[model samples]
Target: MRKRKWSSALLAASAIIAAAGCGSDDPGTVSGSEVYDTCTTSIADNVPAFYKTYFRCVTITMSGDTVVIKTDGLPPHNTYYYGSGHDKYVAFDFSKGSDYHPNPNTLKQQNVTIQIPAAPKARGLTINAAAVDAKVNSSSNEYGLGPRGVALDGVSLFNPLAAPGDDIEDEKYTFDPYNAHPTNNGAYHYHTTSKGPLELLKKLGKTTNTTPGQAEIEVYGMMCDGTLLLGCKELDGSAPAAGLDSQNGHVHDIKDKAGTVHFTGRYHTHVCTSIGSHKYTPEIQYYDTCK
Candidate 1:
């Protein structure tokens, strides 16, 4: 996003932490001891949607000049919605060039311990993670009539349960925009977007840096029966759907002042026929209060 300069006061504070050997050029090389020396480590007091059904914890350990972080949890599902529901869980590969795929093994478990060689000193770093959980059934109303081929065919579009044309957005369904399909007769679901990681890092009080592998992590969420157990769309300041709560969803770039970080949540609707429609309701029983 937009470049941010650390305030003099913040710079001074960061300097103190960096001078103590907490700062390094390489994030992957940071040692556990170094983190303990310069940084105050604390875990998220409350669990987010990623851990609602599954137990998860983030551990930051520092030794001398190293920072070690471990995330332990499991992905809610193996395969989710691609662009269209027509495709099943393909294989997991960033190079595959497909919108949908199987959950990366990197995000499968809650326990991910990373040993960085060094932590950046000039800029702060952020790490993000999430997960989803849902029971899959083939005969349930949650499954759609099959993937909506390309255009908005007779099959349900956004939500299979909707009466059609209820919340159709001309821009979203057009060929230029590339319409999305229903998944497994359940609501449409997809992979984690930039928003998740950004939010995770901001919650940890670290700004994101573009340095290679400086600030990054695999984030995952799941959908079931045409409903989002976790995650939400990027709000445009407009009022949300009726009965849907705004606080339940995630806000993109919570720390960015200029909105430089461009991240949008995935849309998963019409995978199920009885779920009604997609309303961008993300579940967040617990979240870190922004400072």
Candidate 2:
């Protein structure tokens, strides 16, 4: 699949003003103001199957000229903003699906409402009565595949509009789509880190400790034989049968002939933090190319 670029118009309209630069100590600068006009963007394509339950029939409500996001009838989803120029990134915790359980049958047909402060300096946004289920089928990967591995065949990342002076690395970062982890049923889920939704909170200038609401590190590439390579910590004990452990900044050669990837790590549950010295035991699944 071709890479997609976030619309520049949308980015410009959604950009937030930097308050820290003005020596403002107020954390509520962005509370309860709708600056940007409310617009809806569909996640049906961008969101992987693992996150489908949370995204299906969802509508994103953006405050005019501000970064606040509201949703209707969707699972608790995090919103992150990576600032441009000299602006620092910030994340907001909207709601958690795990804590609130709604009837799946009713939720599927319900309409949810999310409200954020208007733009420029909106704050204290609240999401209310959004009908949704926190039931993330632990049995399946976020994707719909059953125990069989989910194929990465159609996935690719590239810039749609590359100018001569554009930084290649930046373009890659913007276009690259991370691979999803497979569940015991071969279904795939979009790990929080891959989608850039949640913002990562840093402690004392350290990149390792991520505070909830910040973006999780992205994992890319898979060995033909099923070894998963990621940019985060290696929570899984030994490397898979093939491929390099990119998580630790070390590259390994592929040893398996089938090119099947395996995620032997534990799922980090922190909303804005990394897995700190924790061991991970992944649920196993296999994927093949979609014909």
Candidate 3:
């Protein structure tokens, strides 16, 4: 989470994307509360263990039945978008594949505010968790453009669709080694599998590897629809169940490797290309409205 800024002046001059700002952590910020040494912020106290323990680079709090997550939309990883003068900048690397190349846009600070259900239910199901219809939430709505979700490492999550005519399968060439790229507005995000969040989990002792299929466990992040995005294996280091849908998604009790159950019969999906060619994030939303 360490990014070296060239100078204080440059920090002051850096322009932020419009219409973004959030926080008011669990207990909210109180001046300068040490969060990251690379940068410091006065995050709130009493924050939920989910946000406090698993996430960074963002501020969060519980407001009624919702988890109000707010982030500046910048990832805590090296990439070409950080700009040459910035420390997070690593020269454009197309080494992973010949198709890799830099995009025309540069990274910019994003103003993003995302609100999701604290306890989610499938769209066609009643709040009581009983199915009433066959209609499921569509990716065209919940997964629409702009901050669809947030990665554990404080990055945004976008869909696989590219800019109108472009193909996301090809646009990935523009992504950094972390498997992420910025949009026209400069917000960096992930649409496919990436080593970024896995690396974070590694540092936290949550897993032993960062490689997708090989990683002991791979939990990308949550979508706005309350869909848990997972990779090759389930959070408990077990194979996904037998009833996954076309998108490799299914519902069951969610547990960490330690066997601590988090959610019951929750909807989640695996998107690891190495596991089976499920290369893109789920395009369909299984849950109801995403705040």
Candidate 2: tens digits of C-alpha lDDT, residues 1-291: 222223445333323322233323222122222121121234222322222211122333233422121233221222122222312212322243232221112111122232222111211222111211112233232222212111111111111112245432232332113212222222222322343221111111112333222323323222222324343432222222322211212223322112322222222121112432211112211222211
What is the TM-score (0 to 1) of candidate 2? 0.21
lDDT of 3 by residue, 261-287 (tens): 777888887986544534767666678
Q: How well does model 2 score by local distance difference test?
A: 0.23
Q: Model 3 misses residue 24 by how many Å?
A: 22
lDDT of 1 at 1: 14
Residue 108 displacement in candidate 3 (angstroms): 1.3
Pick the TM-score winner.
3
Model 3 whole-model lDDT (C-alpha atoms): 0.69
* Ranking 1 against 3 by lDDT, winner: 3
Model 2 regions lying over 4 Å from their true place: 1-6, 16-177, 181-187, 195-268, 271-275, 279-291
Listed in order, each prediction's TM-score against the native is 0.21, 0.21, 0.79
- Clashing pairs counted in every model: 51, 64, 3
